[model samples]
Target chain A: MQYLFFLLAAISVITALVVVAAKSPINSVIALVLCFLSIAGHYILLNAQFLAMVHVIVYTGAILVLMLFVIMLLNMNTIVEVRKPVITRILAVVTGGLLFLVLLAATKQGLSVDVPTGFDPGVGLVKRIGMSLFQDFLLPFEVSSVLFLSAMVGAMMLAKKDGTENVNLPPSSEPDLRQAGPNDSAA
Target chain B: MENVMTAIRVVPLEHYLILSFLLFSIGMVGALVRRNIIIVIMCLELMLNSVNLLLVAFSAYHSDPGGQVMVFFIMLVAAAEVTVGLSILVLMKRNTDGVDMNILNRLKW
Candidate 1:
């Protein structure tokens, strides 16, 4: 069990580093998918089977694929990213290191807090989580549906062709008015 | 099921905390240093995942369903955020012909 935890931790850390360090966006995306998979493994190890499955589906399955599609659509797979200045990159690393140090120090003091509630292995099951979601968190669950709807609308508006460009043009112009026709009706 | 509990019990919770923190810092560094907007966005997702991992760890350790429920909400927000963010990325690419963050300096006064 300890070895499995170490293995998953190592995989997650390495893949996370690769996600940051890989030159190509595609490679980074692939590495990130691997990293998320490792995290799911960690979740399973931690006894959160439902969360583990959800993490795999929502993160590696959905979000990363969405990112990959966008990368491919933009043809960013071939374009090499320009490196930041060496000083800037070094400073970034230093800043992150400092943040990590601070976090470590903050957590170091509380390394062994007694668990207030006894461990329930079944707490992570889908049935338990579903009840919690539908009962205690019902309001947030409903509100999140609203959030999703708004996000869908917002994404469509933002990605629609000539959406922002039309907004910038004068409302009186003939071509602009014609172009805005479809958008207005759609809206 | 019994074996799963014993398996996780072998590892201390602090290790999970350290692992998630490391992942978060790596994401932060990537976001800071990367020039490509998409990669930066990916880094942001990485950070989010690290937090989710921590929350799940705590949830499991404390036997609290609330934490896992919170993770669900976080995922929901994250999904919505990514959709909007990527659409904006597509828009930026369409307008500028490149994904370089430096090109966004036009917004700076």
Candidate 2:
């Protein structure tokens, strides 16, 4: 069990790295999908079966497809992408490394707290999660639906053609591409 | 099933924390360093997933349903965030004719 856990962790970490470092957006998205799958495996190992399934379905099924559609729609390519200053890239790495080190140190301290060693196997079950969602977290759960609705309307409004209110924002000076059409220099 | 539970317990929770920290940092670096807006968004998703993993681990170890419940909420919010964010990205791409993050500097003076 320990070995399997390590293996899954390794897969997840390496795939996450690939997601970060891959030059192509498509490649990064693919790596992210793999990373999410390995994470689902981790969830299963952790006995959060319902969460694992939801993670797989929501991430791999809904999110990945949405990303692919956007990628295809936008027609992103690295050919035109200008590299950032070396100093900025270096700063980014340093910042990330420092964050990792600090968090690792915190984890070392966190380990000092005695967490209950055994798990209640039933907590991860779908029935348990559903009951909690409806009973204890019912308000937040319902609120999230409102959040979703608002997000949908907002996206639609933002993406609409001739939407001048948001167009007043910077970069509105650029030609509205909807008039030029979708395939206009889509590289 | 019983054997799997024992196996999970054998591994310290701190290991999970360290792994998630690494993943989150990588995603942060990617978000900071990458020029493509799409990739940046993907990195954001990666970071969110790392947190979800940590939450699930803690949820299992503590035998608490709340952590997983939180994960579910996070996923829900994440989905909404992605929808709104990608729409904005699409808008950016449409207006700018490219997805490069640098092009967004028009927001500056």
Candidate 3:
């Protein structure tokens, strides 16, 4: 059972490196999907079945596809290898190493590491999570959803129309009376 | 089941930490080195997944499910982020004709 953990950890690390080092965005996205799947495997190992499935469905199924679409839409696979200015590269790598150290240090204090009691799915299954969410963590969950909804609405508005498009709108002082129904006006 | 469990188990919290560290470093390198916006986003996702792996490992070791619950929420955010990010990427591609981050600095200043 524990060897499985080592295997997964290895898979996750390798795929992640591939995601970063892959020369093309398309290749990177594919590698990223594999990385996500491997992480979901770890989730299942933790007995969080719901999270494991959702991790795959949301990230590998939807998000990676969306990224793929964007990459293809832009035809950015022929990526230009832009030389990252040396100072920026050095700063980024240094900051990244510093962040790793911080996280490790913090983790040493807060992380709970015990030997696994074996892969017991029944222990912390989805039902258990639901119980906890609805019981103790309800308020915070609901508030966060509201926040998410607002973010969605704001994003929709930004996508639909803003000041930039007004420059291209036909110069018609007459208000278009067609703005009546749900679809037309909304779109 | 006991036999199976016994054969494959090794414990050194340090290994998980080391793996997470390497994954995170790779992600940061990608973010820093890659100029294409899409590649950078992919790298960011890689970083998030690295963190998720760490959380799950810790949770499994401790026999706690709460960390997994957090993983769920993180996935939710990542989904929403991708949707919004894709829309923005599309809009940017339409306007700018390329997704290069360097060219996008003009949008900044």
How much does each candidate deviate at the interface, measured as C-alpha RMSD after superposition? 1.9, 2.1, 3.4
Best by DockQ: 1
Minimum summed lDDT over a 10-residue window in model 2 chain A is located at: A165-174
State the lDDT of candidate 3 residue by residue for B2-98, as single tens digits.
Answer: 3432322454666767777878888988888778788888888888887887776666556666776777677768767866776777777666667
The alpha-carbon lDDT assigned to residue A172 of candidate 3 equals 54
For candidate 3, the per-residue lDDT at A138 reads: 77
Ranking by DockQ: 1, 2, 3
Q: Which stretches of candidate 1 lie above 4 Å from their native place? A: A163-187
The fnat scores of all predictions, in order, read 0.87, 0.83, 0.52
Task: Residues B3-69, candidate 1: write the lDDT tens digits.
Answer: 7787546777888889999999999999999999998999999999999999988888888899999
Predict model 2's lDDT versus the native. Answer: 0.86
Instruction: List per-model TM-scores for chain B.
Output: 0.95, 0.93, 0.89
lDDT per residue as tens, model 1, A1-187: 8888899999999999998998888999999999989888888887888989988899888999999999988888777678899999999999999999999999999677565445688889999999999999999999999999999999999999864484544556888878899999999
Ranked by TM-score, the better of candidates 1 and 3 is: 1
Scored on chain A only, each candidate's TM-score is: 0.84, 0.83, 0.72
Which regions of candidate 2 are displaced past 4 Å?
A: A115-118, A163-187
Write model 3 residue lDDT over A15-122, tens digit each, in one string: 877776778777888878878787777666555677777788888888888778768877787757676788987888788888778877877778665565565545
Task: Evaluate every candidate with DockQ and list the scores.
Answer: 0.69, 0.67, 0.46
Q: What digit string (tens of lDDT, one per residue) describes model 2 on residues A145-182?
A: 99999999999988887745455356744567564666
> What is the Cα-based lDDT of residue A160 in candidate 3?
71
- Fnat for model 3 comes to 0.52
